[model samples]
Structure formats: structure tokens, C-alpha cells
Target chain A: MTLLSALDYASVAVFALTGALVASRAQLDIVGFIFVACLTALGGGTLRDAILNRDMVFWVADPVMLAVAGSAAVTVFFSAHLLESRYRALLWLDACALAVAVPAGVGVAMGMGSAWPIVIVMGMITGCMGGLMRDVVCNEVPLVLKQGELYVTAAFAGAVAAVVAATFGLETGIALLICAAVTVTLRAGSLALGWRLPVYRARPPRNGPRN
Target chain B: MTLLSALDYASVAVFALTGALVASRAQLDIVGFIFVACLTALGGGTLRDAILNRDMVFWVADPVMLAVAGSAAVTVFFSAHLLESRYRALLWLDACALAVAVPAGVGVAMGMGSAWPIVIVMGMITGCMGGLMRDVVCNEVPLVLKQGELYVTAAFAGAVAAVVAATFGLETGIALLICAAVTVTLRAGSLALGWRLPVYRARPPRNGPRN
Candidate 1:
């Protein structure tokens, strides 16, 4: 497999595991576990392809991805109860998947000759949107939008790193590696070191309301 | 404007209204209202086009749809508090949007000469997915998936009505009209007459656990 495809598969497997863990927490049936796993594994890339108007979505072009996701769900369904802390496992696995997926998005958008803004947005979307959809569908607040989390910020920084690296005439492979490294570092820092962004604090109006 | 386009616009407006009302209930700011409204208005058609690999997503091809959703959001943001029962208004508006959207989906799929099953699924996706996304994003149980409601069932029956009408050599317009009529009737009945489907009832397993 091409390096990009390998990264895609890795991310899909990791994300599916996280999704199935979430399904377990929700007390869903086996079918629900499989559905959520596939959705989480494929949702981000499907959205990025749709926005870019790719001729076919990634999973549609390669049904093996579905098999990968389903296998992950089945494995998790029977095994999740053994984990003492599924939530912790989900966070770490999701960070790893983000590291892989950000580069995949950057590579695909760059290959498509997308503009820099679109490339950055696609990278973040690929890295974060699957988890967002998973949380929403399962009725949890999205980790991407939770107060003080560095999830989206990390994805953004990673995508910008790729763009900057490419602008400096780096090879595509080298740029993507840098992207993945930057993503994982920031995400790991947030998880392990409590790095965070300042959240909005509501305040009274600075001035009286206009008539 | 074509009949299909008109129906599409109508659905977008009504769906946006429901989305904005939901945003009010969520206590989000004006920007949040606009975001949710646009998401609810455009989400379903976007999903349909993406699945079909359409050359351009509907809103991307015609940017005016965004303006329509935005207008609806702004209007509701300013007036939602005046409603005696925002939830009731949301339900009725959502039902109206569903009626128009089902026909739009059937028309687009039929125009592409899709097979009957795809047409039916596309119709349901178009009619129901926007509201599902709206509810999910706003952290509410999805109305589409709620037990006993005729939401998805109504969309299915409507799409089947369209397919059946077309199989009898009816014109596209007539077929879509039948689709809309059936969808609205079922949805309205569910809303006003307490019509419902049988929901699953959990029962203790008769057979003992197997090794």
C-alpha cells in the first residue's frame, strides 16, 4: 500500500476502536456499535471528499475500510468490559489517530492542488470531524468543542506546519511527517501536560444597549 | 424556477426556522443560531449529493441557499422569544419541511435514473437527515430516531409512493406530488392524531445463555 493509504487504514482502525468504546459507554447493541464505528472511521474523510467534490468517497472506492471498521467494532464489543478505563484509552487512541489523519488530509488536499486555506481546513476536518460526529450521534458533547481542549488547535497547527514545510520546498513525504509529528506533540502535550486554550468568559455588556 | 427548486427552497427556509428555534432553546448566540440554521437547511441535500457523487453539491452550485438559511436564522433569532411554544412551532415547521424535501429527493434521484431502493433511501435521507443533524448538534435526542414517531417511516412510505407512481408511467411531477402528499399526511397524522409505529419492548430471553 502507498504510505498515505497505510496511514489512512491505521487512523481508521484507531478511530473505530474509539467509536466502539463510546458505544459501549452508551450501552448500545451490537448493531449500534458497528454503525457508530463505521461512521466514526469514515465520517471525516467522506466529508472532506464531499467538500472537494472527489469523484468517489474514500470508503466507496475501497470497501475494505468497512471491513476494517467492522472488525474493530467486533473486537471492541467483547473486549471493552475488560478495560478499567475505556475513556482514557479512547483519548490516547484518538490522539494517535489524529496524528495520522491530519497528514492524510494534508496529502490528499495537496495532491488535489487545493488552496492553502482549503488544505488547512481539510486537514483539521479529517483529524477532528469523525470524533465530533461520533459524540453528536451518541449524545455527548463533542471533544473538539469542549472547553479548553487543544484538539482543533493542534490539528490547525499541524496543517499549518505542513503548508509551511511545503512552501520551503520540502518533499511531500517530509512535509507530511512533520505534520504528523507536530499534531501528535501538541495533542500529547494537551493530554499529558494539561495544555489548554483560554475559554470564553461571558461578561456584562461594555456599553448600554443602543435604542 | 423549477418546481423542484421551489420545493428545495421552501424546505431550506422551514428547516432553517426549526434549526434557529432549536438554537434559541440551546441558548446559543446569534452566530450559533446562524450556524445551526445553515447546517439544518443544507445538511441533508449535501449528504445526498455527496453519496451520489454529484458534480457539485446543491448549495455550492447555488450559493443563494445559504442566504435563505441565514435569513431564516436572523428572523428567528429576533422573534423566537415571542412564540408561546417554540417546540410546538418547531415540530410543525419541521413536518412541513419534510413534506417538501421528500419530493425533492425523489425528483433528484429519479432524474439521475437511480434504482428504486436508492431512490427511496435518498428520499428518506433528504427528508430526515437535516433535522437529525440539527437535533444531534444541539444535543437533543434525534427526532428521526425517537421511538414510536412516524418520522423515518413517513419518509419511506412517501418515497415508495413516488416509485410506485412512476412505475405506472406517471409523469415525474405527479410522482413527486404523490410522494409529498403521502409524507405530509403521515407526518401530520403523527403530529395531530397521535399516529405511531409499534416500538420495541424489551423482553427477558426465553432461552438460557449459551456457552
Candidate 2:
């Protein structure tokens, strides 16, 4: 298998694991676990494909991706309790998944001869949207929207790197490596250092008697 | 435009209004209103089209839908304060949107020569997913999954009716009318009568200490 394909499977597996961990937290059933996992693993790509008007959704075209995601969910369902620092593990696993997914999307968009803007947006969407969907379905605040760290920003930087590399006619493997490295470094640094964007702190006052 | 096309735009308008109401309650900016409104108006059809691998997203291909949705949101943003029973308006509006959307999706799927199962699923998804995504993004419990109504159940029944009618070689317009009638009857009846499904009241507790 090509290195890119290997990265795709690995990305799916880790993201699915993180999703199953959230399902376990919510005390959902096995079906819920699989649903959440698949959503986390494939939802971004589905949206990207839809926006790009692709002929087939990636997972629909390849059952192997779905199988990998489901297997990851099942494994995590049974084994999540074995870890003490499970939440931490889930976050780190998600970071790795994001790093891989950005390049996967960038590569695909470049292969399709899409514009640079589309390439960057698709890469960021692929990297961040899975977690966004997972958090939304789990009925939690989406981490990407939260004040915690520069999550989507990391994806943006990586995507920009990849897109610029493609514009310069660089090798796909080199572009992928550059993206993965930048994303991982920024994301991991944020986690370690508690870096965060400024949050909206003020709320609009409620209309009352207006007396 | 056909009757079906008119219903589609009407559905988008009402759903977008509800989405903007949610954004108003959340005290979000105008961008948030437009974002949520567009998502609510077009999310279901987007998902249906994606699953069927259609050539284009409905709203993306037809800028009219997005314009209608955005205009509805802008109107709601200015006028919601004049209404005392805004939530009630939102629910009734959602019911109407569901009625229109179920037939819209069923018609599209049948035109595509999809199987009965796909038609039914696409219909239901088209009817309910806009609200589902709206609620999820707004950080509210999705109404379709709530125990306080027969939301998705109504969509399912309508979809089934449409599919069964098509199997008998019914006219497309007739089949669509049947679907809208069933969905509106069931959904509106529940709202009028306070009908609700039995909710699961108990949660399975985690293993001791969950350690």
C-alpha cells in the first residue's frame, strides 16, 4: 500500500478511537459507539466530498475505511477502562489524526486540480470537522469553537503549507510530510503549553420589562 | 417553477427562521445567524444529496435557496423581539418544513431510480436532519431524538407512504401530496395534542468506580 493510504487508515483508526471514548463517556450503546466513531472518522471527508461534488464519498467507495473505523470503535469500547489517563490519551490521539487528515484532504484536492483556496479549506475541514461533529453529536461544546488552544488555526497553517507546496509543484510525499509536521508541532505545543485564543466574554443583555 | 419547487423554497424559509431564532436566543452575531440559518435550511437536502452522490448540493447549485434562507434569518433577527411565544412559532415552523421536505426528498430519490429503502431513508433524512443539525450546533437536544414528540417517526411514516405509493405507479405529484399530508397530520397533531413517545427513564450505570 502507498504511504498516503497508510496515513488514511491510521487517521481513521485514531479518530474512531477518540469518538468511541466520547461514546463511552456518554454511556451510549454499541450502535452509538459505532455511529459516533464513523462520524468522527468520516464525517469531515463526506462534507468535503459533497462540497467538491465528488462522484463518491471516500468511505462509501472503500469499505476498508469503514471497517477500520468500526474495528477501532469496538476495540476502544472494550479497552478504554484499562487506561487511567484516558481523556488525555483521547486528545493526543485526536491531534495525531488531525495532522494526518489535513494532508489527506490536501492531497486529494490537489489531485482533483482544485483551486488553492479550495485545497486549504478542504484540508482544514478534513482535519477539524470530525472532532466538531463528534462533540456536537455528543451534546458537548465543540472543542474547535471553544477558547481552548488554536485547533483549527493549526489545521489552517498546515493546509496553507501543503497548498503552497502544491502550487510550487513539490512532491506529494514532501507536501504531506510538511503538513503533518507543522500540524503536529503546533497542536502538540498548544496542548503542552495551554495556548488558547481569546474567547467572547460578554453576553448581550436579555430584554425584560423594558420599563 | 413547479409546486414541488415552491414547497422547497418555503421549507427553506421557515427552517431558516427557526435557526435564526436560536441564534438570537444565543445572542450570536449576524454571521452566526446566517450560518445557522443556512445550515438549518439546507442541511437535510445536503446530506441526502451527499449520500446519493448527487452532482451538486441543492443550495450551492441554486443560489436562490441560500438567498431565501438568509433573508428569512435577517427578518427574524429584527422581529423576534415582537413575539411573546417565539419557541412555539419555531416548533410549528419546523413541522411545516418537515412536511414539505419529506416529499421533496422522496421525489428526488424516486427520480434517481433509487430503491424503496433508499427513497424512504432519503425522505426521512431530508425531513428531519436540518433540525437535528440545527439543534446540535445550537447545543440543544435534537427535537427528532427527544421523547417529547413523534418527530422522526412522523417523517418515517410519510416517507413510507410515498415509497409505497410509488411502487403502485402513482403520479409523482400525487405521491408527494400523500407524503406531505401524512407528515403534516402526524407532526401537527402531536404539537396540537401534546402527544409524546415513552422515554427511556433509566441509564445503565457504569461498572463499580468505572476504574
Using all chains and alpha carbons, the TM-scores for the candidates as numbered come to 0.62, 0.61
How does each model score on lDDT? 0.87, 0.82
lDDT per residue, candidate 1, A1-211, as tens digits? 9888988999899999989999999999999999999999999998888888988899999999999999999999999989989999999999998999999998899998877866776798798889888998897777765556678778888999999999999998999999999999998998999987544222333443311
Question: Model 1, range B1-211, lDDT digits (tens) per residue?
Answer: 9888998999899999999888777666564566678779988998999889788778766768877998999898777666667778889999999999999988899989999999999999999999998887778889898789899999999999999999999999999999999999999999999999999876667887533
Candidate maximizing lDDT: 1
Q: What does the lDDT read for residue B53 in candidate 2? A: 84
How does model 2 score on DockQ?
0.10
Question: What is the lDDT for B104 in model 2?
Answer: 91
Q: Quality of candidate 2's docking, in CAPRI categories? A: incorrect
DockQ of 1: 0.08
List the candidate 2 regions with Cα displacement exceeding 4 Å. A1-39, A50-86, A114-121, A136-139, A145-150, A153-178, A185-211, B1-43, B46-96, B113-125, B133-141, B144-208
Q: Each prediction's DockQ?
A: 0.08, 0.10
Tens digits of per-residue lDDT, candidate 2, A1-211, equal 8767777788888889989887777655454566578879988887888788788777656667877988998887677776665667778998999999999888788789998899999999888999998988877678787576878988999999987776698998899889999998889888988777677665655865433
Model 1 stretches astray by more than 4 angstroms: A1-46, A55-128, A137-139, A143-211, B202-211
